[model samples]
Target: MVWKLPLHESGHPENELTAESDGAVIRRTVLPGGVRVVSEQLPGQRSASIGAWVNVGSRDEQSGHFGSTHFLEHLLFKGTKRRSAMDIAEAFDAVGGEANAVTGKENTCYYARVLDTDLPMAVDVISDMITSATIDPAELETERGVILEELAMNDDDPGDVVHEQFSAAVLKGHDLGRPIGGTPDTINAVPREAVWEHYQEHYQPETLVFTAAGNIDHDVLCADISQALKVGGWDLTPGVAPRARRDTTPIVGLGQESVEMTIHRSVEQANVIIGSTGITATDDRRFQLSVLTAILGGGMSSRMFQEIRERRGLAYSTYCFGSSHVGTGTFGLYAGCTPARIDEVTELMVGELEKMADSGITPAELERTIGQLSGSLVLGLEDSGSRMNRLGRAELVTGELYSVDESLKRIREVTAQEVQVLAQELASRPRSIVRVGPFGS
Candidate 1:
């Protein structure tokens, strides 16, 4: 935000992964209970965001309790030892701030964004919910109806329905392949203790991180976070696998629901999911894969949108993204196009990847892609929420905080030769695909 914002925070290993423009002071501290803290100072902004990201998500669900993580997320909003769900909402609403939480494949995060004056209060309310969450049976039953409604909502959307099926198909057996939200039946069947025990096991200090970004005094943050971390009286258990990780058959997890909504009355838009075996959060070559994603589908001027939309007008939208967890990652491409163009679209998406694998990207494409990515990185920090996510996710995956300059350096170092080697090896490698359309599949 100022001239000092340009200097990168040095000495943190994870910074190389997330920061883009080094404009803040990044600090890391380890507290009792194995909890990690990442605090970043963003000068000249009035808003701040604090996020508590736990290192477990839907994939961590045990059999018969398939959607435990997501279910648990809902129950947290019901109430906690220190506050009712409504009371929690009112506190933030009184100040016009926002509070929310989400469950993902490898982690669960609860965050609040508020004016800098409210950071301390925001921290307490959020910390209370995560460490002191109490799930009442009556509340879980009520939440069941809410979850079922969510499932119904997903069923009504063709795109969501197919992606859910894709997750089911891809991980066939791995937690990574499962939906973050469990099935209605599984959600109903889970007992209170099962969900409670999960928190005990997964929400350990070592596996959790408290992150804050924007408009806060650094010394105050250190003290406030230290106090927030101290409020939770629960003892964290060590050495337990957060949840049993299961392996499933590798397959193209595809599903179809045709004719239910009057097949011919609707224009045909097939949803496609192409994914492959994972990479690690700490992998050095991740930037290469990121560059490949941009060149292929990042913008209207990029490869997919340019060739598919600008040049030939073969489809409406196409894009590719690569994601990595602590132990696994995926490079996936998604597209929506008319049924008549499905085969051609799929072919083009796969073909470009193959071409890039065989013949590396041109020098111009590499330069543009690298530059675009660097710019995007710097822009993301403008939002306190984005900055918090950057820090929270960084602590979860690599256990370090980075300065923005450190992150941009890594992107700048991504080379055409590096991307080609990585892309070629990955594209040639097997990928599980899922498609939902009118043509028998």
Candidate 2:
């Protein structure tokens, strides 16, 4: 069934049954410092997945803290008050559990998966890292070199560069356009103190969300996290609320009708991306956009794949993609092909999108796309990690959570007309094109 966004009203209840259906149960508990403990119980599972989601990312970086969000992501795992870096690493290695973190434009997550018995240890370790990262000056210096190398590695890939350029062209003058891994210049300029200040400012209890899935008991998990955070020295005083939802005003582009950018790179294959700003995270037409995306370039049978690869053999890979954020999102298609055929591939990609907008998908295509999206959603939730991600992202990002079945229903109900309407809107928006390859040798 459909679930409403969690209540963020001041003095929200300490415990609430967010959603329950079939054999699965979902519950949420708010702690003294506004730390949220949300969990889903899946019977007959021996493993559990947990994540500590912080509601800040590169987009939230202040003047001196560019790239510090991702920087902290690495530093947290370096050491904590109680556990050394090696101790943290060995803790998971000894148990055969997996742990990692991701820094996104909007949030950062430190997550892990382990046997049900080891959930407590996992919780304690991640909580320690989140609340007690030492961020040693020496360690920060070392990671600086490491992050610089990471940025270099990313720049080495033309496919990656093209997408980055496309975002810069589309979301020009916006924080979202900046690379998540800050540029080398920015990284070198940011002082260790800047990172420390960033950590202290954003890593508050109210900005933290703890979510777990599989063979989990809500109350036990909440108590464990409370003790862990307390040991890590977070203020647990009562009367605080979780961070408010991000403002939902749509961010529009401020430029001419279209923009084209080309970066000269010595690469065998040219990479290209053509797209435009699309929708917001809370847009109602997201389901329709999904259907349209799949129909145009999602898979082997998709129009772009069939024409660009199967029929013409102009490219080795071609696909469509979209990313949504609080205010604006991106919609684009990419292809890596022989430099000689770049023009043909670009035309084909644009033509496919235009065709879809001019003439909506047939009934057969609509049915197939709906099934494709529905099956993908169901299959992705077969494990605890995926379910944990669903819960965490729903609570953190859109603030709305839907059961697997409910999500499937939404996809299935998208009408072809709706998909066409979205396609027409996206097609009409000003486009940005980014090309990366050797042009004049």
Off by over 4 Å in 1: 1-21, 226-232, 235-267
150-236: candidate 1 lDDT, tens digit per residue: 987776676776566655654455667677787777777887788778877777655666788887765576567557656767554
Model 2, range 1-441, lDDT digits (tens) per residue? 766556453246534656785478998777888888789999899999999999998888878889899999999999987888999999999999999999999999999999999999999999999999999999999999999999999999998899888887888888998888899999999998999999999999988999899999888898899999999999887877788878888875533368988899998999999999878888888888888889999999999999999999899899998888889898998999998889889999999999989998999999998889988887888888999988888888787788777788889899988988888988898888989999775
Q: Model 1 Cα displacement at 245 (Å)?
A: 15
- Model 2 Cα shift for residue 187 (angstroms): 0.9
Best by lDDT: 2
TM values, all candidates: 0.85, 0.97
Candidate 2 achieves a global lDDT of 0.88
Candidate 2 residues lying further than 4 Å off, grouped into runs, are 7-11, 254-256
Cα RMSD, model 1: 6.2
